[model samples]
Target: MAGELNGKIAAVTGGASGIGLASVESMLSAGAQVVIVDRDAIALKAICDRYGDAAIPLVIDLLDPVDCATLIPKILELCGQLDILHCNAGSYVGGDLIENDTSAIDRMMNLNVNVVMKNVHDVLPHMIERGSGDIIVTSSLAAHFPTPWEPVYASSKWAINCFVQTVRRQVFKHGIRVGSISPGPVITALLSDWPPEKLQEARDSGSLLETSEVAEVVMFMLTRPRGMTIRDVVMMPTNFDL
Candidate 1:
């Protein structure tokens, strides 16, 4: 198990921070070289420095379909082959939709929904030709339940959930595994944007999870025996109310 991923190369979007950063660290420790893709050039460089030769940092905007299309080819250029694609980049907007501007909604949908579709579309052909690969996405508990506070965010996650399920079947014939991890209220910068009262409530109730917890699930999905493919995993703090 020490070199479970000895020959694999992985690309993690949003890999500069939070759950994405945690997954990057775990994959590297599991004996895989990883490409850290994010818009934060500074953080990407810092992570690449920390991991040295194990990490290749690519600074790119996930919201741009054009940029998303370029990711796998760029990754292949850097690492030679890509065996895993972790689409962990996403954005959130809270409060009632009435108060959310149309442009804000568009940005949210573009990042949370469009980017995932584009990444998968662009990566599928290469994966299919190779006859094997894995695609893991970061979904959310919000996808399973309607949350009034972050309606748009929840809807976006729902879209990803559907995408994972449908695409998993499509790629199974090609030996590709597609799945998602849905975590509730993780203590990441993503949660830093929550309304002040909601953040306080989650903190007071000890219902916030750490980034590493979700990262563990990512590794779990990757390391499963080839005969067994975990389709979805939902992770939440023990005390999480919803």
Candidate 2:
């Protein structure tokens, strides 16, 4: 039998590292042609070199609305048509609101919240026109809880959660599926920024999640049959408190 995603085209944002990198590898293994989008030009070029024709690298910042608008069209120009979009690029800022600098909050919101909105806005029209597509946003478990340790990061996720649900409802008739994966405390560079005490606590408690696990979930969501849609997947390590 053929690979489930053979002949499909996918675009993965923040595809240079961590969960984004893992997701890109998974999609390629499943026989999809993918365009890896990221601001890390060096890393993106390396991936393209490693994967050769299976990967196309686009090095551009997603913060600009114009860049987001051009992304899908550029992906289509490369691979003909788009079948999947993984909005997996995001940043995390951990600390109390008072202690955190205003600049940090602004950057976090712009990256985690605004960028996501722009990408979705740019991609949705094409998906609607084609009447088929799958959109998977990399959400956080914080979206479902009051994560006092990372309130701004939590707020960004909360906004994404709402966007995914509302957009799913709006586009269901157009044969597009929009959903999010809410994973708890993934072991990525993002976690490196956590307070040392909090990191130690999670390490002692064995609550840290691996990036590949999240990639597997993204694969699962994308490979489902046409008529089925898994709206939200809430994933957490067994010992995590929230």
Candidate 3:
């Protein structure tokens, strides 16, 4: 499995930390040259340095529609051929809906939903031209369940679920594979928004998933044969309850 992705090129958004970082590491170990995309230049530089030539850093704030539009083209320019694109950059907004400001909601939705869609849209023409490619969007378990505590965040992922499915249908004929990985409560900065008591409870119950665990699922989705597309993978900690 170490060289399963040898000769492939991958671009992962939010690759500076957390799930994105873990996925980048996984891809590198599999022998793929990965482009690490993130807004933090320092983190990008550090990661790229640690991984040497296999990890390429691209720093851009994906929240800017103008910048997000440039992502695919930039990756194409850098890698020549982008075999995989993991839209893992996202933001979290938890707590009662009324407690969140409109600006925060807009930011979360833009990063979680809009950016994923835009990146996928921009990459399609290239992948379709090649007649083969893999696209994986990082979704969340909230997308499939009604979460009152984080209604806005859940709504954003729900939109992602629909988007991934629809695009998968449209691109299957082009030899492109589209899918999403939905994991629950991964231990990342995203959990900082959770109520302190709830966070503690999840910790006590061993209901938190590590970033590496989710990255393994991402790898699983990416490595499957071209003939079979994994539509979506929903994973959560065994102790995690809705």
Off by over 4 Å in 3: none
| Pairs clashing within candidate 2 | none
Measured with C-alpha atoms, the lDDT of residue 241 in candidate 2 is 63
Put the candidates in lDDT order, highest first: 3, 1, 2
> Tens-digit lDDT track for model 1 on 1-242?
35878989999999999999999999999899999999999998888988899899898887776776788889878877789999999888888888898898999898888898899998999899999999999999999999888889899999989999999998899999999999998988887767799889888988999999899999999999877799999889999965
User: Candidate 3, residues 1-242: lDDT per residue as tens digits?
Assistant: 59999999999999999999999999999999999999999999999889999999999999988888889899889989999999999998888888899999999999999899889989999999999999999999999999988899999999999999999999999999999999998999888867799999999999999999998988888888889899999999999875
- On TM-score, the candidate that comes out on top is 3
Q: Worst lDDT window (10 residues) for model 3? A: 186-195
Q: Which residue runs does candidate 1 get wrong by more than 4 Å?
A: none
Evaluate all candidate structures by whole-model CA lDDT and list the values in order.
0.90, 0.89, 0.93
lDDT of 1 at 181: 95
Cα misplacement distance, residue 84 of candidate 3 (Å): 0.3
Candidates' TM-scores? 0.96, 0.94, 0.97
**Which window of 10 residues has the lowest lDDT sum in candidate 2?**
63-72
Assess the local accuracy of residue 46 in candidate 3 as a C-alpha lDDT between 0 and 100.
93
